[model samples]
Target: MGWLAAGADHEVRLDAGRVVARNRQGRVLRSVPKAVRETEAYLELRQLHEWLVRHETACREQVEQWLVRSLPVPTALIVEVWADEAWRAPLRDLVVMPVDDAGRWDTDRAGLLRDADVDKGLGVVDLDGETGRLTSTQIVLPHPVRLPDLTDLREFATDLGVKQGTRQLFREVWTRPDDADARRRELTRYAAAHYRELRHLQARATAAGYRVQGGTATVKIWEDGVPVVASVWIGEGDPAWETETGPLGFTDPAGGPVRPDDVGPVAWSEGMRMAAALHAGRVIAEDEESA
Candidate 1:
């Protein structure tokens, strides 16, 4: 059952990617049906994504720079990062769906969320006794990442840039003289747990001839002139988790990693690749008869 479920999930995700790619191609085809080709569609999608990122950031920079001082630094940063993770987690399970469904899987607008066979990954919930409706709450399969809000001292110093206050607060909060040994142990444990995931990603990337920097904690992998994807293993106190540049979110009140499983598939088989596979004129609906 697990095997079938996993494979089905992969196929579903792949199908969803194909659908997105097809829609993208269709847009170009509509505009210039006589001239648009597969190559053009692929190039257009790639360029469009690049343009979107640039425009989004460009428009936000003025606001971000203006609010830099008054903004709730740590909390705002953590929430932004957490939101990113939340968005990606769903697609991770979806990737396995496509592999499971083979050539008969279908997907709707909500992407993998709409797949009927998604119950396992969705995690079972008890039906309400009165209404007979299943619980709407869904727990993340991999432990959710948590982010913590900064204390008043940390926040003031961070936002105000009071040099002495910031230095003193850091010493008192992050590096208390009395608990140095205990803090080391906690930091060590966090690093150890993140090592396995980092190593797996590094190995795959290295075998693909990519140069990897940083270890199991936070890594930056680059394929020379092609592209770079940085997989940062965020921790509760990691400074990197406190900025809009990251893709994580922290719970209100106390910020922390919302979900560790937010890291979706390390593979990039979505969008164009999925569409290319389907464009060979193959149908992708799920088939249960074979099993």
Candidate 2:
């Protein structure tokens, strides 16, 4: 972006989401002069940087939502957003597979996204280390949990030396166990985690993108196209007081308890993921440390 004049001697422009200033001699300044900072050009650049930061975050979150939902994304949409760096960054190198009209994935057509061209097609690098363009109009970026031979894909990704902007290939996954009793306890495996303070736990949950309600840290997932809410009981009362987390559980849209068997693969994985993230922040007490 061209530098905008700040008064007569100073000029300012955005540099990697920051407002930077330069002298009239065209020498870059180490710091934005205090006087120039108050100029309209500096303030506008600062405001633009803030909006860009928010746009980047929103773009990444939207891509994550697509991965979690396994939604079919049209190439046209990709083409439209490809020019925007905020959207391009998160969508880069993600595994994508062509989807049939009936919403079925063609595993053989799976590849790592590289480029999107409106006139040509979606460009990708397949599993065998071949680069090509997928002419399919719509494609699904399958979640790691749904991919076949996930171990092979991980090894392949490692070989390609490609880093995915969105968490997919290397993301942790969990599957519902076959035994009924095991399924029942699947959601509760991370229970009894300890935190020094309720506020700390609440803050952790919020930072992890989970909602902290009155007495629970919750995450809602759309499994099988139905809303499934998973919650972990974080004791209520004074936020600064010490607290312990309770068992994780899931409920339907109506707030009715969802049966363990009824919880689908995606819901089970996501519910466990939420609990595990919170549990990771748990503090081991003195006595427990000795034990």
What would the TM-scores of all predictions be? 0.21, 0.95
- Write the residue-wise lDDT of candidate 1 on 86-196 in tens digits: 322322221111111122211111111111222322211111111111112221111001102224434543564434311122321221123445423422221212222
**Counted clashes in each candidate structure:** 46, 0
Instruction: Give lDDT for model 2.
Output: 0.88
Encode model 2's per-residue lDDT on 1-291: one tens digit a residue. 999999989989888768888998999999999999999988888888888899999999999988888878887898899999899999999999888889888999888999999888899988888999988879987777888968888888999897999999998899889999988776678889988799999999999999988799888887646789988998889988888888889898778999888888887888889989888899977897799
Tell me the whole-model lDDT of each prediction, alpha carbons only.
0.25, 0.88
Q: By TM-score, who's the top model here?
A: 2
